[model samples]
Target: MAAYLKARIDLGTLEAGNKLPPTAALMKQFDLSDNAVYRGIALLKAEGYVHSQQGKGVFVSDRRRLIAGANRIKGITSPGESIHHKLSARVEAPDWVAADLGEGECVNRVRTVNRGDFILQASQSWVHLDVAEVVPEVDEPQACDPTWQAIYEQRSGNPVGVASKTVDARITSAADREALGLDADFAVLVMRSVYVTGDKVIGVGEGVYAPGHPLAIA
Candidate 1:
């Protein structure tokens, strides 16, 4: 489906904000089962290639933003640690989610922790309802041991092949302040990223880190 989506996207058949064919339509087109179609979109959603709504339909997300955002994950090293590149997965729905999921849409909280010290918080907002529904495990607590390898392998039944990251600076919004345990003094480093395979986008994520935890982008 990533190939199909990419082909369409590259050919201008699908542009940013364009709605993808419904699951039923895609099922018929690809001759796939319900589970296959659903998992494909879930993989796309996780990779930031698309966004799906409850009653509406699936659509293309800003892939440029996704591509640019992937640059931020360059250096995982913090002051005390060489590179604390641990992560944890969860399912959570939040109201204050951002607009990346095609305006007025929201996503669940996917809090990723790096080691036992630096904490990275993200509200994953592009998941479709169908994909979100199938995710059985939701709402993970603050994880002390963060690892994305096991979780990704289990969710998609494949190991991650490649990942791209983007890094930029952002203000601490009211929601960010509350969620990340930030005070008025701290600014956040916005890390946008996409994890990909040969023909699939496995994960698309945006993380905000507190001020003291400097993100080395060069």
Candidate 2:
């Protein structure tokens, strides 16, 4: 039932901000009791498909429209976004980080991004030692205002040309669930990003986002 409703939203039959039929009408159409109808809506809500208002009923969420589809991701921070949490330091590269950036010490920046009060996703980035050395602020993180991508381009005499991204769907880790404030285990979208400037790759990043969260490829 939830999938049926989601299909409608995705196909634009329901459209964003469209109010759902009354609960009883939905129950009747689906041949479900009140509890079953509610359960369906609850599932949809978890997937960022719809939202309930105090007295206005359920409606499609605009967030789903701006989101990335097929699990593809981009770390383009929109205006008004902020860093919910961040930790930056120099550390030995993890195996995955080494695979992308090489087997050496790198500046690790771990951060959780927020849109308004909503937690968006958590990402861990590994930067080439040279970039961090030249841009000392790279080791001391700040707001998500200027994306790490933007920082990598600023005053380095080279402009970022392309960003490559790959994504995988996997089980959410306990630590990440805590970071995203999830109360239960759910599958998450794991995204890997490599940023390139001139002919050199400057950094690699991995981000974890909750299910139903909108994908950003901007």
Candidate 3:
């Protein structure tokens, strides 16, 4: 099942913002176990190939398109060197993200990077305002570059800790396009990450990215 999806992604048959077929349809098409289908999506989400929302459907992520199907997984912590390119620290943070992160307290770090002039915009997100004091250095944690990585690692030290995430695909709202510096034709990749720390819900983080940017998953 993983190999099949990998083939599709590699062939550009499934680009960023391309919604996956509905669960039942997918299961029927592949004649897969409900568990297998769910597990495949879970792997894709962790690798940053897809993002999910509660009511919305799963969608491909910008990073998924950027790397041309790089097989990276998101939210896994490694003690070695970083796998992702360093995002420029100067990306402007948006104000409307407060609603996206939902209540409590949130941090939005946006940046437009250049590889000698090519521009790529990205957002590093974090939530769980309730744990603000508990983890003061949310803005810049050496162990965790992405907000989701920081929260997941701080809460669960295991690099293999499992997470259940959903992916959604939607036309880019005017505000989303403007914020990501994308055009009306572009779509936003929304991922809702639910962290489970030893069978207990520790926190939830959302990762949003525009097309053409590859998501860095360990």
Global local distance difference test of model 3: 0.51
After TM-score superposition, the amount by which residue 44's alpha carbon in candidate 1 deviates from its true location, in angstroms, is 34
lDDT score of model 1?
A: 0.52
Off by over 4 Å in 2: 1-81, 115-118, 144-148, 216-218
Ranking of predictions according to TM-score: 2, 3, 1
Q: Candidate 3 versus the native: TM-score?
A: 0.39
Off by over 4 Å in 1: 1-107, 112-135, 138-159
Residue 214: error of model 1 in Å? 3.3
Question: In candidate 1, residue 97 scores what lDDT?
Answer: 28
Writing each residue's lDDT as its tens digit, candidate 1 over 1-218 gives 65677545533346568898887888899999889999988887876678887788888875544542223232122233323323333433233222222233222434544435545554342332333343433223322112232344446666543355566787788977765665675667876655444455534566777667533443
**Taking the tens digit of each residue's C-alpha lDDT, what string does model 3 give over 102-187?**
44445443343333333343334443443344454444433232334444455546322225655666677775665555656676
| Candidate 1 displacement at residue 8 in angstroms | 34
TM-score of each: 0.38, 0.56, 0.39
> Could you give me the TM-score of model 1 versus the true structure?
0.38
Worst 10 residues of 3 by lDDT: 73-82
Q: Score candidate 2 by lDDT.
A: 0.72
